[model samples]
Target: MTASIIEHQDLGTGTEEPVATAAPDLARPLIPNPQSSIPLSTTPQDHHIARMAAVALGLTLIENAIPTPLPGVKPGLANIVTLIVLTRYGWRVAAWVSLLRVLAGSLLFGSFLTPGFFLSLAGAVCSLVVLAFAQHLPTRWFGAVSHSIYAAFAHITGQMLVVYLWLIPHAGITYLIPIFATAALIFGTVNGLIAARFMNSKNEMLIHENNERHEIG
Candidate 1:
């Protein structure tokens, strides 16, 4: 997602400060920090992270089950979890979940440490990097949809670079760019919309729970 930099006047300082305003609906408060009573060895946060990773792995497995007409053209269903975690938890959690998904998913598929694993790893790292920067942008201008598109293109770009440098050196490989780009665009937008719906649903649930608690009190 692209962010629009807003210039804010600092009356006290008599200077303009650039404010990055995320869309009110899209931007959420950070998850509350875990309690100090929780031991460092095993914490509630770890369980939450594990759950996120498990969901992502489940999605990866489902995608793996489907047969694709074109190679490397999967819908990337696993990324939905990454998007959700990134938006709700933070980049660190999102990165950990994504890397765990790639590692565990590759192992389950019996492609651990192989070219496929590396390819997946490369794409994930690239996508995470793009997301890291994109998250800083104004949410109104760069919400989940734009973030997905950005990550999609970054993933393809990273894989293509790897293919050219290590797997296939031939210039003919460049011909595949358009096909990959087209797929990325379609899948990215679809994934973003789905994630957005999920996010909204979750947000509503949270709001309802809070209201119920307030009324009970």
Candidate 2:
């Protein structure tokens, strides 16, 4: 392959000529062929979901750093991002973010396909199911806090079921439900407040910008 550039003869002169230069090795291929590389065909919504998922995954990493008293008990900091996505986009995008966070988080922590992964997956699915119906609730009463709380409860409930049926298979596990539920309530409310505040700030910023634009116009 050959490449050319327009070159001026003098510092002040605008007259130009094509100067040949060595081009990138097309034969070797700088970029892999689409078929060979198997790139994903994605749209704007897909990109949006991916970006949201990435943010949630970061939160997951952060949550992992925080110490927990017991196994399977997490603050679920990523769900805050999911709530934001759900209210802004809808359940589908939120579901995508939640599931992606679980999958990606497991892969990142080297726990993919493990019991922990399944537990995480079950929690995500249950939360998403609750969110699907919760989103339809009237905005007058139900908002981010309600949705988050409901989702958190659903998440813990799902995990408890998994623990009793698959992992432990003992009546003792049910006793831990209250402990998990309490944790869910506390963390869920806090997460909901944070998400609500963030969304409010974002909306106010957007409103201010729009008002300034209108003034200029």
Model number with the top TM-score? 2
- lDDT, candidate 2, 5-62, per-residue tens: 1121122111232323337567754335545664343344555677788889999988
**Tens-digit per-residue lDDT, 75-129, candidate 1:** 9999998998888878998998999999999989999988888999999999999
Which stretches of candidate 1 lie above 4 Å from their native place? 1-40, 202-217
My TM-score estimates for the predictions, one after another, are 0.75, 0.78
Report the Cα lDDT for residue 83, model 2.
99
Indicate the residue-level lDDT of 62 in model 1. 86
What is the Cα-based TM-score of model 1? 0.75
Show where candidate 2 strays beyond 4 Å.
Answer: 1-35, 203-217
